[model samples]
Target chain A: MYTTWWPPITLSHSRRDQLLRALLWSCASVAGLMLVCIVAFLILESAPALSHPGWRRFFTDAAWHPTEDAYALWPMLAGTLLSTGGAVLLAAPLGIGTAVFCQWYAPAWLAVPCRRLIELLAGIPSVVFGFWGLVALVPLINQWQPPGASLLAGICILTMMILPTTSLLAQASLAQADPDALRAAAALGFGRWGTLRRVVLPSCAAGLLTAGLLAASRALGETMAVLMVCGNVVQLPSSLFDPVRTLTANMALEIPYAAGRHRSVLFVSGLLLLLLVISLVGSATWVRRALRHV
Target chain B: MNAGRAWIPLLLVLAATAGCGDSPDARQPLTKLSITGSSTMAPLIAAIGKRFERRHPGVRIDVQTGGSSRGVADTRSGLAHIGMVSRALRALEQRDLVGTPVARDGIGLIVHNTNPVGALTPRQVVALYTGGMTTWRPVSGKDASVVVVNKAEGRATLELFLKYFHLTNAEIRADVIIGDNEQGIKFVAGNPHAIGYVSNGAAEYALRHEVPIKRLPLTTASAPPAAGHPAPSPLARPLTLVTTRRPPALAQAFIAFAASSHVHDLVAAHYFVPLAA
Candidate 1:
């Protein structure tokens, strides 16, 4: 029954399985390699700062002067978290609302073009986004502050950038909701709005959570757009109107000038960013596990 | 023969992609020369690189512009053979890394050609920027509301203007800061209500392409207008070429090319004043 078909010969079942296993192993190896690279680089570059001053200073000190050997992380960390939080808060409701409309109510003509536009937006380079933000968003914020760049400007720019990612994920989540459940709800006397509110939300809960986490991750890593709009002062942001520099912006702005112990400090900051990303991803994994248990 | 001929173009393309411009001597061991920092010194360094290539041929020179402060750090780390900068080394830098002043230049202020106001005094410029004074009624000229423009941070000319004008931590209203010098100049050039500053090397588009804007001379003492003219703007700062080391050989060679007597003519021809000359 398993006779050979050609001189070249057909692949045996075992050979096929072996090939698949090889591919799977190679993919795992690639993932392992990337993780090793990030960890090694972070440890190696951060050696100078770790060796000279205690690791406590990286978390405690307030100033980042290298000459006197200060490596404070609070001001930059606060700015990063605040701006990212502001961006998520502004974009989430709007993006989810837009996705809901597109999926449940928007006409095909409008929805299709709009979806394409959002995808195109995600494809635009960070530098281009920075220029657009500098020209379009920052000026509008300056109207309120009257002559200085501020956290609000950076937030607004980020809101526009994060919209595409959030909307895309939200739409994917909405699409994953069972249409059959909606039809059944209508048969059970539930209105379109009620069905979506009750049946749709329950079914797509995991998808929606994933979408939210994905957007948050993107907001944390965004660099150039924030740098252009944020005033780039390394200080605790007192008000939305005040200028502040985010962690990523500080690293980018100072990395070129930073060396030795200072360079190591930047790597430490990068490691901190990695830790933040890992925690977020870990939370997502835990949520998925809890969903499976349910 | 036909197949081999067909492969020639493909082979050539591959060779080009694999670093065609790389010299056979790229693998050769020679004294490495690295220059980093100061985009303002790009013209001078580029000019020097061309001449140095011909003279030494064997020695490799790498010049980079990482702003002023970055140059100092790179030099200190031994990442670069020499640092090229437009700003002065800080106290730490002087102790850690040596510095040599190669040539001198004056930071020049520029305005759009269409702008009617010719010159600004040191005080008037500051007033317009910070004190919220608008409408250029220079020491004598007719009044026109002035719009201020600024370049991105870390630009040598920008750093000098801010320091000379005493604007440290002074934020420009976000509405006016442009990404690069040319854009700022273009923004001013297109609008008669705008004014900005740039290095002398950056004057071409701001002053040359259309109408040449005048440089406002800055001095502590008051100098009144000439006849029917408003006094020149007294806002000037030195243009400097900074180095991280005492000056490595190739760096010295490049500096020689930039500072040679002929280079003086070249500098002025490009609108920069060669102080040594």
Candidate 2:
């Protein structure tokens, strides 16, 4: 509160706040600009395609047929949800466990190396993972299933890719848990796992959720590896081994040669992706608000 | 005198280097026609653009190869002045969209040179891709799996190969994967148990495996033959220059020029068959 504590500037006290506010405003505007640009392009591009009953069929129907133009999103949506859900299912437990290991159980000597390996795996390019999965992982998976590159292959890849971020965040959150609470729980004769579950994990729930959201975004926008491994068949996915495609992969694959309404349909697909992401964001915001109220 | 003489030689070398860097007026920067599409059409489009620029100074043509499907889509969305595709126009292709044939490219199945199985019937290739033949045992007289390599999904090659062969829902064995054309070639060359198909232009005939891995013959498409294009139709499709609307004047000029007989010979020399009648 003292004058010496003030930021250095030859201006009135209000100037600093004004500059800070302007900087924040500009940063926010830049991000908003990207969203606006995508929306504008999507609306304009999809206008032609959306005019037809085919658009409704595409959005509502479960089937997709390029030969007959019976485009549909239900099957694709199901595939997307399944792959992403499977990824989350695998990643959540491992991520939390790894975080727990890093935050509490793992020897200090092993922590950095373990984290680094996870990071390196995640940092490897998606295309590299695609090649590796195709060359190495899928073949292994095929030992059980006759053919590989199934939804399961994609999920495994996504899990491996998402692990580093999820674990890192969970680690940070768990690390930030109140020491006093853990000490009290220990004093009360609670076991280490008991304290971790009852107290530490509850406190870190917020960060864990954040990690989940980050992984979700990765699963959604993921194009190359999933495209390579997901068998790209358009029927409703029946099992984890079923071949599938994601919205982004479809756009990447189809956008090149599509014309007129078909091109617009791809953009519409993009718009659908945008809406899906926004809905997730909305839910995340709602969760945060509810958490704050609690 | 020696200093002056040395300067003259250096200047001459510099002049030659600069001259060779780009033709002073060749491939001029004019209407900025940006074309992107199939890697198969890349060389052909680049050849056409180079000739187009040489003829029309001050016009720039930017041609990109992102693969054919994207090219066609880009043209539809007006993102490209032209799109080049290796495959024919699908039923889903825009009604207003039209294409002029640049050349006919022969597609051939490629295998590891070490693969002793010299050639496959089109039926056999179809069977292999549709997951009918999973092992190299019968073909090579060895007990090993046949790694079937395919283009990425939604690729023009997948469509062309499938449609031509009358196969459906063909999946690349998750176990056998190649990232791109080059990788697929290398994978086949190195693996000794892999098979794939590539356009003749994109197919490396001079690679170490080229001689060993022979091009599998494709049966002719059922068609009424016009005079210029012969029977046994070379298993070729028309490589097209796709634009959303007719390209700007300079690009159109180049397109017209590409359709000319002079460049037509150049296309054939590059091993692309002349466009279908």
Candidate 3:
């Protein structure tokens, strides 16, 4: 009797399976389509700027006075790159070091709390971080250096904002390390630090690089914290103490009052930012693949 | 399980129907009055709107801020019943829109309280901003370098400042460019050698809170106040509410309410100077 009931049930199950597969495929395509639409919209909106005043002015102009038609984007672009690069250079080592210590060296009682705190830090809003930076960090720096809101303040705030991201990803990568390899290193009479250096680190180099790339991307797109602390001067910073404005910060500050060509130029900035992020993600993927062969 | 699965679609249909029926027009005809523009006046108008709502039931007033241009544009397009313009309307705008003056706000220069400089002439102020004079010693203050803090482009304060001083944006050698009046105040308050300008009303309110900044009196060489009379502000502009040339009855009522003596207390509480009766 059970055998006779099977054919109809199997037929119905296959029908449901086909329906689910079609639904999921459509959902994925919709997401991809939405991304395409956004790119198209940005290009369309920025076309007026690209044609008038031309792209040359964007690269060569001295300052970023959009209302006056001086659209030099180099200073803000440099500000964004320098701040993001400086933040990643400082944050990556600290985050990875914390992850390594918690995984291997920290006692159980300490490690649990440390992990929980990192998780908690990740959940805090970026605006709250910006406010705290403005209230606490800017004044402290002002004591040592006049005009405390500068590129250095922006980098410090960004490093704090992205630490949890790098740390959590590094911890995840460390967990995937082969337990057999660790024991083998111990059997070879290698010290704990030596084992980590020779075996554990080499094994997860790709994952660690991925973790760093993700954190860099996050810092690149951060607006509020950098805007609040970075003094927003449309000039290239000569020193760490000098104030600078990033591309994202410039867009946020001016987009509300922007009109006509000014508004289109802001969209151009958005398009440039999108391209940078894509290239970053592409390079990360390529590096991960290259590291696998080694 | 089949019965439960069947109810899901039914429940979704019921939810969709309920959402559609909950639209304001279907439930009741609510007359919503939309007001837009000028971040400076948004707070004041919002407070007045709350009081108006309490008095007139079934009337709604929506207030939004996106700078004065948006206010002007929105009123012309009929997107808003009234637009809050922080400055007086130009002749071009006055042709299509009628402006009702509600209060007065003046743009004034501010510096940290510790600075010895008490007053700056219009010429001296222009020189400091244009990078002609870079040190405080030139302005009779400390020997330290002067940090010029300027408002970003498109701000009404920046526009008024530039127009009054006859200086273009490119001429300003700003060490730091800040957005909004609060940021400008905060930056000046933090840096002892920095000079920035913001709304007089906003600066006065900050002073009440003991923010370590002082507003300098703006004196022009061309016209000095008569003896026994206080010096009038050279940077003052009217805070006006703009409407179409022929406004609806409801908009007219609200405009009258806004400009009347009844709301003078509300205007003064926000630190704005109430218009003379």
Best by lDDT: 3
Over 4 Å off, model 1: A1-24, A51-55, A58-71, A291-294, B1-35, B47-63, B68-82, B87-100, B107-217, B221-253, B269-271
What is the DockQ ranking, best to worst? 3, 1, 2
**Each model's DockQ score:** 0.16, 0.16, 0.50
The candidate that achieves the highest TM-score relative to the unseen native structure: 3
* lDDT tens digits by residue: candidate 2, A1-294: 456643455456465566575677889999999989989989888887788645668767645655446678767777777888889889989998998887778898998888888778777898888777766776565555634657888898888888887888788778888889988999999998899889888777777887787777778778888876775656566777666777877777666656556677788888888887888767766765676455
Q: What interface Cα RMSD is found for model 2?
A: 8.9
Q: What is the Cα-based TM-score of model 3?
A: 0.89
Candidate 1 lDDT, tens digit per residue, A1-294?
477654334355565555656667899999999999989988888877777686888678866555455677778788888998898898988888888988888899999988898899888887787777666665565544533357887788888888888889889988987778878898999987898899987777777777777777888888877877676656777788776777787677666555567677878888888788788878877775676455
Q: Rank by lDDT, highest first.
A: 3, 2, 1
Task: Please write out the lDDT profile of model 1 over residues B10-125, one tens digit for every residue.
Answer: 89999889885533234445455677776667667666666667677676666677666667666666566667767566687677665556455556566645455545667776
Tens-digit lDDT track for model 3 on A1-294? 245652333455555665666577899999999999999999999899999888898999988889887999889999999999999999999999999999989999999999999999999999989988877888788778867889999999999999999999999999898999999999999998999999999999999999999899999999988988898988889899999999899888887777789989999998888888899999889988999899
Query: Which ranges of candidate 3 are over 4 A from the true structure?
Result: A1-30, B1-30, B90-98, B221-232, B244-246
Give candidate 3's chain B TM-score: 0.83
Cα lDDT of model 3 by residue, B154-228, tens digit? 888898999999999999988888888888888888788889999877887798899999878765634665463
DockQ of candidate 3 is 0.50
